[model samples]
Target: MAGFDDITKKAQSFLQDGKVQDALKSEKAEDVSDKVFDGVADAVKKVTGGKYDDKIDKARDEADKRIGNE
Candidate 1:
């Protein structure tokens, strides 16, 4: 039976072929940058007491580009 390894391999293959990226570029997924990354960056900043806000925002912008939202 298929298991976690099979799922992981399939997911990796999909990412390698840019399928996941294309999917993320869809209109439904377009707001993922603000909806997801903003919360992530906020949490990181809170954890670090806001010391890394600038760096976190920069990294978040880079990640947003990867997700096709930038």
Candidate 2:
């Protein structure tokens, strides 16, 4: 789970980008966020050989919810 934390932290940092925040408030917020999160998770999957794919995806999904709620 340590790997999960590490990746999620990185993902969170990515989420902090101004572009991401802007994207979250766009007309297509859900679609944009989903694409971005899926892209990030896909990259993590490749880098970690899918070992942490589940964790990455789970974190991305939860983050998506938070973004949507906000």
Candidate 3:
């Protein structure tokens, strides 16, 4: 299981480096939040074998909402 701190750090790096925009572009901006969320979710799922699927999904939804609001 990946630690929450590690996940957060990775996300912070993405934001700090402006990689989030790249990701959003790659995802065609369908839903910036969903794309970003799914990218992280998929990575976590791959590493943990779906152990955090639900949490990731909810996180993604929240992220999507936040992005939409921004």
Highest lDDT: which candidate? 2
lDDT per residue, candidate 1, 1-70, as tens digits?
5798899999888887766777777766768666798899999999999898999999988887766445
| Cα error of candidate 2 at position 30, Å | 0.5
> Which segments of candidate 2 are over 4 A away from where they belong?
1-27
User: How many residue pairs clash in each candidate at the backbone level?
Assistant: 0, 0, 0
Q: For model 3, how does the per-residue alpha-carbon lDDT over 1-70 read when each residue is reduced to its tens digit?
A: 5699899999888776766755554545656556567788899889989898888788777667545433
Q: After superposition, how far is residue 9 of candidate 1 from its true place, in Å?
A: 3.4
Off-target runs (Cα >4 Å) in candidate 3 are 1-30
Higher-lDDT candidate of 1 and 3? 1
lDDT of 2 at 55: 90
lDDT of 2 by residue, 1-70 (tens): 9999999999999999999877776668877777888898898899999898779988998888866433
TM-score per candidate: 0.71, 0.57, 0.47
Model 3, residue 30: distance off in Å is: 5.6
TM-score of 2: 0.57
Model 1 C-alpha RMSD vs. true structure (Å) is 3.0
